[model samples]
Target: MPKRLTLTEAQQQMLDLPAELTNEPIIITKDGQPVMAAMSYEHLTSLLETLEILSDTEFAEKLRESMAQADRGETISWEDAQKQLGQ
Candidate 1:
């Protein structure tokens, strides 16, 4: 479960939390309403790397499909394709 902390408490405890616990994210609150989160650099970097890999896989599949269509002479020029797409 996500940890909760008042903004002031979060500030006070910031330096005391372990690296792993720091990365576990804390939901900061203001007047009992959630305001922000405290997350570690390691977690953020891992998330970013995961996103990059997912995007790369999607792009690679798209590139391969485009290449296959080109080989089959089923692909149009960029200008024509743009016009067809109403761009």
Candidate 2:
């Protein structure tokens, strides 16, 4: 988990954002109430991608089915995946 800090502290360390966010997020709180975060672009991008995937019901369903199939010992070769996707 990321470390938590007051918003003021984050402002003081604004110049070190890149290095500070290299490994974990910095959660900024206000009046002791959680408010914001300071994170790396890479982390933000990953979160956005996760949101996109989770928002796609069809894709999520397909992924769930794939997991179930794998658990059932069903498998497919990478060549077959390429063929199916016409790659």
Candidate 3:
């Protein structure tokens, strides 16, 4: 779970958190209501990329199909794939 901190407390200790801890979002609250969230750049980028993929209908369908195929063991060896692609 992400850590929760008051706005003032976040300002004081956000930067002091260990690098591993920063991977999770830090929920900042003001007057006991959530006001903002902070996360590492890498985490933000990954979320954005996932959002992009999910928002594209064709790509998302293709991803689901690919995952289902893998689950069904419909996969080729890397060398066979490379050969098919003439790589």
Q: Identify the candidate with maximal lDDT.
A: 2
All candidates in order of lDDT, best leading: 2, 3, 1
TM-score of every candidate relative to the true structure: 0.55, 0.75, 0.76
**lDDT score at residue 81, model 2, on the 0-100 scale:** 91
**Residue 13, model 2, lDDT:** 79
Off by over 4 Å in 1: 18-23, 57-87
Instruction: Residues 1-87, candidate 3: write the lDDT tens digits.
Output: 778989999878856754645559888899999999878888889999999889999999999999999999999999999999999
Query: What is the lDDT, from 0 to 100, of the residue 55 in candidate 2?
Result: 93
- lDDT of all predictions: 0.82, 0.90, 0.86
Model 2: residues >4 Å from true position, as ranges? 76-87
* Angstrom error at residue 51, model 1: 1.6
Clashing pairs in 2: none
